[model samples]
Target: MSGVPTGSSGDLENKDILSYVALGDSFTEGMSDPYPDSDSVPNGRYRGWADRVAEHLADHVSEVRYANLAVRGRLIAQIRDEQVPRAVEMSPDLITLCAGGNDIIRPGSDPDKVVEIFESMIAELRSTGARVVIFTGFDTNWQPVMRHLRGKIATYNMHMRSVADRYGCDVVDVWSMRILDDQRAWNWDRLHLSSEGHRRLALRVCEVLDLPVDDDWNRPWPPPEPRGWRSARQEDLHWAREFLVPWIGRRLTGRSSGDGVSPKRPELQRCERYRPGD
Candidate 1:
């Protein structure tokens, strides 16, 4: 969609938006899609949920300057080190965070650490006087594997809820909203979301951002079915057993590991170099 429609009947007009920042991992970066033109590199510009959110905001709000600093395969530490600093520097009026999935998938990483990082991030965001939005949910394909880590997810979400309550920020319950036991909402990799999944997520984010949802926005633009679906049960389990499990084992055992894995990229021309003063 081009821009998000405000629920109002007026023509699309820019509002006096100060600024907004989006920070997180692959999910926030829209890992599966091709990156936008503005990115410094192909990988740098994946059109994830952050892009969707920004587009929607642009349609309805006239005066917003939105910057998405999300990266694929970013863990909590990586976000803290890279994304958060840039976001804080922007001094945004609004901020959205969608992360922790990679951390959960990482070997040897404690789920508690995820919660701790989220809490710290929220605290820091609040200190900046920005209205914060936190997204909570996981793709259905990962649910089975996440079952072991469900408790940790719950705890992390609970912590987020408490922080939001204390700080008067918005919390989007995306997890309960999008995940359904009967349907598959993930891609073949069983990690990234399907296009339909991204649309669903974008709509929910629109709601949280208080943007208007049009018929097009709610119509499931990509259509979930006819694309064919996979039963999470029928998928290969060897990857989890051979790759993920062992990787996590090594992480827990204090072996140095790189960021979990790079995501698949669409073929595209490399963008111009990102210069601070370009």
Candidate 2:
């Protein structure tokens, strides 16, 4: 669908966007990425796609207020119950919602129920008359045990598309990127996206928002070196020990990696530029 034109939409001219709020889980919180220690980036803020998008918007647009309400390891329900209220109160001109990834990946998850809850959240956010941007969950085609959840992810993506249609919101189709299926796009955990992966996501979102961008994230990378079976098995064992085991234990104990974590950009303020030249 064509996006809303900035000219007659009354959303601030390209130079005067007031506020932009982002809401979601680890994907939005930018789990694997680190916040730079410079003045440009907030101390310990995850420079994830949401922040990346905000940086770009701030460069082209002026007085742009940005807030990231995302927290890592949050469920769709938690986002709806927790983040939705603040986002509604903020009532920014633009808002991004990228939840439900954590729910679809878990065992015994019901895609229909997840979609219902997600749609409800989107509906609530849309009521504020903000331009809501949503994302599809990528498939874990390269991961061994996680690949089985691909069908559930696909089901959730379909629901997201439907919600975007019903709510007149924008959808970033991350699931069909194909590049994300490659192991290189993932971090050591094999669940979260690497820094490069987040970069590509920022570009894709820029396209969805009808913003100018230099990189074409759809381009595939050069062929990777093939690993021997023994090496592959050893790497898999290490990943299971370091990431998978701990993730499972936390789930069993009802603990989350983001239990005490708060958002990096909790308030709507001027966003600093990130590598503007690039």
Candidate 3:
């Protein structure tokens, strides 16, 4: 439950990490955070934590080939059936997997069952001798409706830790990263991390990998602007109408935000670091 320390034995520091692949749901897909230099590009990509980590690795190594096989709204089963095999085939030097968030949040979902499938995916990925990385779901106890699901999330996180231990994998324990308790860390939808949140997570991942970083993941943010009850209620109403309602409707109809959406970067290609005003 403490902050992730630097220079741990689990670090992939000295490995010839020439290639990396990321796998999972919306969290791994990099939602709510648009690429910074995307003003000139229409429908620019969501550069999430995985991409940021890839960019950092690219800087340290010679031509770090990176691929992200994550799609938003994917279930654990979908990831196992769809993305896991492809990642194994690619045989990257490193792999990051963060699935099961969508499943644990769904109605009538069983954490045990979800983690069982997740463990299988981890087992297969480890078989390739790639250094595998996994993530724990964020603590949503402070959020509304989602707060009720925190129990399930915690259950899943516990199992994830045990599995990671058994599989010799690294973990970016999002649940223990208390700096993410701020509202500014979330996007308007409250489902995915904001740009700032993604940046912090990237730093955490780098720390786990024993990669060099210039910023602190635990750095404090500027003071938040205060809002009155009426203003807060109005914003909540707008969020429910614009995001919450549509999300629930899609679930009822068995539709997903990623119904036809493809992975942003499917092939193992060189990654460029994202810079402001580039």
Candidate 4:
């Protein structure tokens, strides 16, 4: 990927500007969210944690450039073979990496192999004169079937922290931020993230990058109250009579209700994070 020049010449006033490169998988690609607009674009092209981190940085810093080369479903080897070279060519001041989810999902994939690839990527990024490298861990809700994968994820995170410590890079603990001891946070699929999850993640990334903190990032945003239980019950019954009854009838008796009922993969609820004074 080519380096996108950022900040005006006037923005640089006797201070060295920092260039950033963000690399990783679907979470890094801002999957499951609409792309943020340009004035909102600062950290990277993708609007995940990286972009949010950039937004926070914009409050305190002026001269910063970023390149995002993350793609959905990319494994460690693919990143090692492809993304690392492009990132190195950019000569970034900081590199943030989020990977290893796909590896955990694939059968017969070894965690040690994933670690090796990540370490190689780190070494290559460090060669680019980047002062600091930030590595992120997988969210606990990566998959419901692979619940045991958490141990592997932990192993990889431990390796990442050790490698970062050895090479003087920073480690962001995203896993802990999203996966608490409680169950209020995960999305419907028990994978991916809820809006609250993303908000918390964005705030933590800002903290790890040493960027200015936003108080709105920490406040709780409650869901809107339903019209009323009676109204909701009526609405539910109407839906059952209007849609569900016909769909079930068609499925059970091989009859055509002409409703075109196709089950869709469960989507995470699109709840917006609470902003101050909203």
Candidate 5:
């Protein structure tokens, strides 16, 4: 849908999404998707869909202001109480909010409660008069261990469609993006998207926003090499060591990946990566 509602000038196409604010958890913070000069991942410099979406807009419009307040490992409540107020203060022209993933995964958390709180937060953002871009949780049918949360994720996504419609917001429908279903689209951790996943997510956001972009999020991936049972088992063990362990540790200790981190770009500016040449 065009960013702006039916208008005399139809300006959503021509007008720049001058001010953009992204608020959520690691998904919005761009985890596992490192930037060229990425710092201690917690420093939050990873360039994910929000940043890429901003750059796409900056390319078309004269200027665009963007800020990302997302922090990895944050629950839905923290995002609502902390990031939402800051985002509303910014009064961005465009806002992308993708939280609740953290909550849905917690052992005892209720997906419905998470969505309830999440929608309320979105309403608060909508009150700012900014066009909100929402996302349904991705399908994780490929990840065996993560399958337990699949039902919860699906529940959240199902409610999300109606919630987005109620808010007049754009839904990116990550669940329906078949391209992301590919194993290559995900990082080794299987919990977060890889760089390619982020790129595709950026494309999907541009599509929803009705912006001009050349890339296709649905482009096919090359054939994969066959893996024997032993190697597959080894890969699973390594994944548990590298990603799952730390994730569970964080949940147990009450520490966060973004505990002391700040947004890479607190204010909007031209995305240098998009500029001509390095």
Candidate 6:
């Protein structure tokens, strides 16, 4: 990998990854970012960064099989139990895992404990002789409520780096991506990335894979519109009511946004440009 730090044992000598399996939570599942001309997909399917990256890979190679086994509101344990084993069975040449964010943001959750589970998943994936990549928690300092969880996120990110090093895995360091600091990079809910944000992330992931991309993920944004104190507070209240409260309620009720959701592309298929209906 050119820009991404790698472990001693795993290296991508060939950029031509034949098969890729994406495993993780909402971020990997593509929350908030909708498909073109559709607010939602056939079955809550989201064309997230992982899908975009798969499409990019398909662009260069003759064929690349891909599957995204991610669902929203999944805890670290759920991912480890449900996704990791399936990925290993698929035996893909490349895998990208971004778990534990849901667990980390919860009250009283331990980053050390989360990483322990995370490391186990990576160890199992590496056992299949597959190249693995992991994503770090994003720096959430840009949002007021999310900023409160920054310490926990930072702690988890540190452990993630160490685990990647030990496993010889590649890393997508979202914590250091300053481009996401802009508000436009996030969806209106302020929880997941916007379409533009996902696009940028796709570019970053390609770069990490040593894949050629025409766009720059680090491009600067125009100046943000200045908001008065009262306006800012009103917006915050709206966000809380619209997004934060529902999220908290789900946690309290032990319900998930993905309670009955199934993985969009559960089976490995030839990567193709995501059309509106597909």
Question: Weakest 10 consecutive residues, lDDT, candidate 4?
Answer: 261-270
Error of 4 at 13 (Å): 12
Residue-level lDDT for 103 in candidate 6:
94
Model 3 lDDT, full chain set: 0.86
Top-down lDDT ranking: 3, 6, 2, 5, 1, 4
Q: Per-residue lDDT for 134-240 in model 1, tens only?
A: 87755343456556766666666676677667666678886576343324445555567765566567777777666787734334334455533354334456557
TM-score head-to-head 5 vs 6, winner: 6
Model 6: weakest 10-residue lDDT segment is 1-10
Candidate 5 accuracy as TM-score: 0.90
Residue range 43-89, candidate 2, lDDT tens digits: 44567788888887876787778999898889999999989999999
Residue 261, candidate 4: how far off, in angstroms?
Answer: 29
How does candidate 5 score on lDDT? 0.79
Against the reference, the lDDT scores of all candidates come to 0.61, 0.82, 0.86, 0.56, 0.79, 0.86
Candidate 1 Cα outliers beyond 4 Å, as residue runs: 1-14, 35-42, 107-109, 139-142, 178-184, 216-278
The stretch of ten residues in a row with the least summed lDDT in candidate 3 is 1-10
Residue-pair clashes per candidate, as listed? Answer: 8, 0, 0, 0, 1, 1
Q: How close is each model in CA RMSD to the real structure?
A: 8.7, 3.7, 4.4, 11.3, 3.5, 3.9
Candidate 4 structure, TM-score to reference:
0.65
Better of 4 and 5 by lDDT: 5
Question: Per-residue lDDT tens digits of candidate 6, residues 1-278?
Answer: 23332343333434455788999888999986777776457466578899999988887776789999999889999999999889988989889999999999999999999999998888888877787888989898887777899999999999989988877888999999999989999988998998889999999999998889998999898888888999988988999899899999999999998888999888899887665543
Question: Considering every candidate listed, which one attains the maximal TM-score?
Answer: 3
> Which segments of candidate 2 are over 4 A away from where they belong?
1-15, 36-43, 276-278
Predicted candidate 5 versus true structure: per-residue lDDT over 21-98, tens digit per residue? 888887888877877665566555587878778777777777777788888778889988888988888887888889
* Cα deviation of 67, candidate 5, in Å: 0.6
The residue pairs in collision within model 5 are 66-268
In candidate 3, what are the lDDT values of residues 135-248, reduced to their tens digit? 999999879869999899999999999988877888998999999999889998888899999999999999988899999999998888888999999999999999999999
